[model samples]
Target: MLKSWRRRCRRKTGGMPELTIPSHFLCPISLHLMKDPVTLSTGTTYDRHSIETWIEAGNRTCPVTSQVLRDLEPIPNHAIRKNIQEWCVENGSRGIERIPTPRIPITSTEVSEMLVRVSEASDESRCREFVAKIKQSAKESDRNKRCFVANGSTKVLSAAFAAFSNADETVTVLAEILSAMITLTPVLDEETSSNLSSEHPLQKLVWFLRFGSLSARRNAVLALRSILSFDQFKFEIVVKIEGMVEALIRLINEPICPTTTKASLLSIYYLLKPTENSKGIAITLTEMGLVEKLLEMAVDSDRSVCEKALGVLDRMCSHGEVRERARGNALMIPLLVKKVLRVSGMATEFSVSILLKIVRGDEGEEERAAAAVEALQAGAFQKLLLVLQIGSDEVSKEKVTELLKVMNGYRNRIECVDSLDFKHLRRPF
Candidate 1:
C-alpha cells in the first residue's frame, strides 16, 4: 500500500526521483515512510516515533533530526500536520526495515587544503570569516556533516596548528577549532573519537603543550581549558590529559620545553580538576606513583612550571587521601621548600599563601601543622630571610614580613632562624 502511494506520489510529481530511503530510516513498528517525523522540540525530523516519543517523553530529541533535542517548544505548522496524517495512513502499521548502518564519506583533500590555507592565511578577519563559512557549510551540507564525522580532517587541523606558531595566531586557531569540535562532538559517533584525523586537533593541542613555541603553548593551554566543559568529550579529554601528563613529566626531565611552556602544561592540569567521576583517574595516577614525578616539577628550573606545580599540588593536597599518599612518599616537603626559595618572586608569594592555608588544619591540626613546621625548618624561614635581605622593593619586603609573622606564630618545636638583620632587610626599601 505504501509502495502504491509512493508510486502515485511519484506519478503525480511527474517521475521525480524515487523516495528510496535506506531501511534504517524506516520506522520499525510501521514499515513505511516515517510519520509525524518525530518532530523534536527543536524542529529536527527523525523517522522513529518511539525514539522521538521517548525523547518527548523526556528532554531528548529534535522532531526532525533526532539530535538529542533539549529545551523544546511547540512549533505549529499546517504542512507538518498534513504530512503526519498522510504518513500514518500509508505506513503507520508496517514493520520497521532491517537496514545496515550508513557509511558517511570522508572529507576530500580539497576541503582539507582549503582549511589549511584559511588557517595559515595572514588576514585574521578573513580566516575567521572562512571558519564561519565552514561551520555554516557543515550545518547545511549533508556531505560536510558526514565528512566532519567520518574523516575528522587531521590534515586541516594540523595545518591550522602549524600555521599559528605565534601566541595570538595560535589562540585564534585554537578558538576556532575548539568551537567546531564542541559543536560536532555530541552529534558524532563514539568511534569518531578514535579517528586519527578527528583526533588531530587534540593531538596538535598536546604537541603545543609539549613542543610548540611558548606563545603556542600558552594558547593551546587556554584553548584546552575550555574543552573540559564538554560532557560528551570527557572520555577523550581524560585520555588526552593522561597522555599530556606523561609527556610533560618526560619533558620536564629532559630540559627541553621552556619554563613557560612547562608552566603552561602544568596549568592545563588544573583544567582537568578531578570531579566525582574523575576520582578514579586521580587514584590511578597516584597509585602509579606520579606523586614523585609531580613533585619533581615543583623544583623545575622553569619558573612557570614551578608555580603551576605548586598550584597543582595545592589542588591535590585538598584531597586528604592523595595528600597523605604524597606525604608518605616523601614528595611534599622538598617541593614546599622549593616553592619558598627557587620560584619567581610572585610564585614565592603564592606558595607561601598556599602553605598558610595547608597549615590551617583542613587535614587535622596535629599532622598538617607538624608537616608545616618541618617544611618551615627545611629552609623556608632561611629563604624568607634571604629574600628580605636582597629584596629590591617594598612588595618583596612586605611579603617577607608576612611570611615571618606566620612562621613566628607557628613556633612549635621548629627553631626560629634569626631575623634578617632588620637593618639590612630594610635597606632595600
Candidate 2:
C-alpha cells in the first residue's frame, strides 16, 4: 500500500520520487512544510508568512486554536526550522530543496535608532547613507514597515524631507526619504498620520507628484491615498493646498502607468466624497477639466479603470455645477449608457446613478427632458430595458426603472426603421 501511494505521488508530481513530509514539520495555518517557522504566544507554530499575513489582516487570534493572542510578536522556532532543513537534505533525490534561513524581522528599537541616525547626521553624504539604509530596511518586508510606523518613522521622515527638500544637492536623499515614507504609509498610526499630514510633509508630497520621477510620483500618490484615508478632516487641509488638486488631476490626464492612474482616481474620489465641505471640491474638480478626463477614461479602458472613473464621475455629478459640466460633454450620456451592464455591477450602478442625476433635471424640467431625449438617442432606452431583463442589484434596478419611465415618453422621438430590411438581414430560420 505504501509503494502504491509512492507510485501515485510520483505520477502526480511528474515522476519525482515521493517522500512524506513529517506532520510536525507543517505549519498549522498553511499545512505546507514550514519554511521559517515561528511560535506564537499560543504555543502554536506557523510559517512566518502565514502568521504575519494573518496578523497584518487584523486578526488577533491564533488561527489554529482560536485563542486570543496576548503577544503579537512571533518567536522564531529554530528547532522546527532545523528539523525541516534536515528532512529536506535527506530527501534531496526526491526533489525537496532546503529552505534558506529567513532574516530576522526588524524590531521597533532598531527602527527608532535608525531614525535617530538619519536625524543627527551632520553632512549630506552621511545623511544620504543613513536614509538609504532606512529605505532598504523598509523595502525588505511589511513587518519592517510596521516596525517603522510603530517607531514614529513617519514624523521623522517628514522632518527630514522638509530639511533636505530645499537643497537640490540632496535630491537623492530626498528621494530615498520619500520612498521610505511611502512604505510606512500603509501602517501609520493616528499620531504618525497627523505628523505626516502637517503642511510641510503634505506640500513636499505634492511637489514630488509634480516634479519627481515617474516612480517617485506613483509613490507620492499612494502615500497621499493612505494619509487621506485616515481622517475626513484632512480633506479640508488637502483641498486648500496649492496645486494639490491639480497635481492629482494631471496624473489622471497623463498617467505614468495604470497603477498611478488608479491611485489618482481613488485620491480624487476620497477628496470629493460627500461631506459638508466637499461640495466646493466637486465644483473645483469640474472646473479643472476633471469631468472631461473622467469621461474619456470611462469610455474605454479595463474594467477596473472604468469602474473607478465612473465611480468618481458619479460622486462629482452630485453637485449642480458638476452635473452641468457632465451635461455639456458630448460623450457623457453615451459613455454612461455604454458602461451600464458592460462593466462590473458597481460600474453599472455608478453609471446608472450618474445618468439618473443628469436626467433628473433639478435645473429645470425642460433641461431634464432634453437630457432624456439625448439618452434615448444614444440607445439608453434599449440598454435600460436589457438591464431590467438581465436582473441587477436593487439600486441599479430601481434607477433603471426610473430612467425607463423618464425615457419612455421620448421613445417616439428617437428615429427607428419602420420595417426590417429583410433583403440584407440574415436569419437562422
Candidate 3:
C-alpha cells in the first residue's frame, strides 16, 4: 500500500520527485519557502515579514526553539535567498514562479547623496518626484523602513527635504516630504525630533494641512503624529501654528476616510496629554466641539474606528469642562451607553470609563449631582445593571461596580434609580 501511494504521488509530480522545498530554504518560523530570508541571533532563519511581525508584537523568544531573543537584529540571508531564486527559476516550468530580487534598502551613503541631490533640485516637481520615490521605497516593507531610518535618513530628510515646496503649488512636495518623514518615525531619536522641530521649517507642514489636497492633509496629520510621538513639548509648538488646532478639529467633522480621521484623533490625543497654566488640552478640543465629532464617530461601523474615537472621548471627558460639553452634545451619553458591550473590549473599557468619570464628577459641584440625575433619567443606571448582569471583563465589571455605587448615592436625586436595581447591579461584586 505504501509503495502504491508513493508511485501515485511520483506520477502526480511528473517524476520530478515530490514538489518539496529544500529544508534550508524554508523559514523556521513559517515553515514555508522563504522569501526575503534573514537570520536572527538565535541562528534561526525566517522570512523577514514573519520575524518583523513577531518582534513588533514584543515577543522576545525565538519562534522555533523558544530561545530568548538577545537581539532583534536580523542579518539578511543573501546567499540563501539567491539559491532559492535559482531553484524557483529551475522549477519555473513545473509551476514555481521565479521571485524577483528584492530591492536593496537605502544605505547611509545613498541617503546622504540623495539628500544632497534633493537639496540641489531645481524645481518643486523634481523635489517631490524624488521624495515620492523615497516614500514608495520605504513603504515596501518593515525591513526597508528600518533600514531607511537606521541609515541617517531621518536626519537628512528632516533637515533638507522638509523645506522643499513650490511657490505656486507647494502642497505636493510638502505633503510628500511629510509622508516620507513619517516612515522614519519608528527609529526617530529624541534629538532628531527636536532638531527637526526647532528648525521651525516644517510649520509649513501644519499650514498646508488646511488648504492642501486630501492626500497632503493625510500625510501632514500623520507626520504630526509621528513627530509629536517623540516629544510631548513639540505638540504645544504644533498647536501654536495658527489655524493648526482648528484645522485638525475640522478634520474630524470632514467626511474623510478612517485612516485620516484616526490620525487626526491621535494627534489630538497627544496634544491633549500636556497642560499649560493648569489648563487641560481637552478645553481646546471641547471648545472646538470635538466631543460631538467623536460622538459621531463612536457609532462608526468599523470597530477600530469606534475604539479610537472612544479613547479620545475617555481622555476628554476626564476634564470637567469637556464632560459638561459632552453632556450638552446629548449624543455623548447615549452613544457611550450603547457601545458598552457592542464594540471591542477596549471600546467597552473606554466607554465605561467615560461614564464612570461623569458619575464621579467634581467635588462640591451641585451640577454634577444634577448631571448624574440626568444620566440616570437617560437610562444609564439600567444600562449599567444590564452590563453587570450579562457579565464583562474584570476591568469592566469593576468599573460597573464603581458606577453603580456613585449612581446609588444619587438615587435620592434621581427618581428613576430603584433600590432593587442596586441589588442586581452590585451583585457582580
Candidate 4:
C-alpha cells in the first residue's frame, strides 16, 4: 500500500522528479540566491537577525558593494520564527512541514550590492534605472519602504535630487508630488492638519525647503504657497503660514544665514500674497503683529531681502485695509520712497512700478496722487529722465513715454519756470 501511494504521488507530480523532502521545510533566508551572501564573523550565513541588527545601527549597505540596502527594516524569519512560535503553541504535537522552500530569486544583500555598484556606475542608462527603483520604493506603503525614505541619509537625498535635476524630470517630479498633496488633502483630518503621519506633510515640506536645490526650492515653495489660496486646506494652510513665519523670523534675526534668509523671505512673499482664501493669512499676520516686523525687513540692509519684503508689502497693499494700515503706520511710505530713490535705475523702475499700484485709483486718488506728485516733484522724474537719457539704447521707449505721461499728468498743477520741449523728450536723446 505504501508503494502504491508513492506511485500515485509520482503520477500526480507528472514528469517532475520525486521530492526527497517537501521544499517548504527549508529556510528561505539561507535559500535566497545571494551572489556573495553575507557570512557572519562566526562563519555562519548572515541571517535575518544579523541583518536587522546592522539595519538598526543605520548601516544599510551591503558588505561587498557598499550599495545602500534600501529595504532595511526587519522582517520575520519565516523559517525560524514561525517554527519556534508553532513549537511553543502546539508543544510539538504537529511536526513541522517537510516542504522544501524555494529560494528567493534575490536577497537584500544581493540587492544592496547591486544598487551600490549601480550608484557608482558610469552608465547613464543604468543610473536611471537605479533612480527609478529608489522612487518606486518610496511610493510603497511597506514599513521597509517608509524606513528607507525616512532614513534621510545624504546619499538617498542626493540621488533623488540628482535624478530630477533635469528640467523635464524636475517638472515631472513636482507635478507628481503636487498631485499627491491635492489628492491626499481631502482625506486629511481637519482638526489637527496632520496627514497619516504624526509629522504633517508640511514638515516634509520644510525638509525640502531646507535641503532642496534652487529650482527645487522654488518649486516646493510654489506648491506649498498655492495651498494658501484654498479654503479647504485652511488648517494645512495655517501650518504652512506658521512654518513660513518662523522661517522668516529666523532669517530676519540671523544675518549669518543669508541664503536661507533670502530664500525664506521670498517663500513668504509667495505664501502671503493677496488671494481670496489668504484673507485669513492677513489676519493671522496682523494677529501675530507681523506688520512691524515685515516693515522692518523691508528696510533691511540686504538688498535682496529688502526688495523681497517690499514686494510682499506691495502685494499686501492691494488690500485697502492693509494699505491703510501700512500708510497709517507712517514708516512704510518714507521707506518705500527711499527704496524708489536709492536703488539702481532698473530697480528704481521696478520700485516705481510697484508704487504705481498703490497710487492707481480714484478711491484714495488724491492721497495717492499727492504721493506720486511729491515723488515726481522731488526730482524723481528728472532722475528717471536722466536714466532714459544716458542709459543704453536698449531702454524701452514705451517706458520713457510712460514716464513722460506720468509727468504730463501733473504738468498742469506745477508751473514750468523753463519751457521744456516735448519734442525733445519724444526723441531718444
On TM-score, the leading prediction is: 2
Candidates, ranked, TM-score: 2, 3, 4, 1
Q: Among all windows of ten consecutive residues in candidate 4, which has the lowest summed lDDT?
A: 188-197
Kindly provide the TM-score of model 2 when superposed on the true structure, using C-alpha atoms.
0.71
Candidate ranking (lDDT, best to worst): 2, 3, 1, 4
Worst 10 residues of 1 by lDDT: 95-104
Q: Could you tell me which residue pairs clash in candidate 3?
A: none
Cα distance off (Å), candidate 4, residue 302: 2.9
Error of 1 at 355 (Å): 2.1
lDDT measured at residue 173 in model 3 versus the true structure, 0 to 100: 66
lDDT of each: 0.54, 0.81, 0.73, 0.48
Native-referenced Cα lDDT, model 1: 0.54
The per-residue C-alpha lDDT of model 1 at residue 218 equals 49
User: TM-scores across all candidates?
Assistant: 0.40, 0.71, 0.67, 0.41
Per residue, candidate 3 scores C-alpha lDDT tens digits across 344-416 of 7788789889988886777446766766777777777877888888888787899989988887888776578
lDDT of 2 by residue, 1-429 (tens): 235556666787777655677899988878888898999999999999999999989999999899999999999999999998898888665556778988888887788788899888767788878878877887788788778777778888767876775555666777777777776674445554566676666777888888889878988898787677775445777878888888998898888889788889988888877788789888888888888988888777899999999989888888888888788888888888888788888898898899999988578778788888888777787778888998987877898999788788877877622234356777788
Model 4 Cα lDDT, one tens digit per residue, 68-157: 665544333344534434433442222223323323333345446545744474544555555455545444433334343333322333
Can you tell me which runs of candidate 1 are displaced by over 4 Å?
1-264, 274-281, 329-331, 379-409, 418-429
Q: For model 4, what is the alpha-carbon lDDT of residue 406?
A: 60
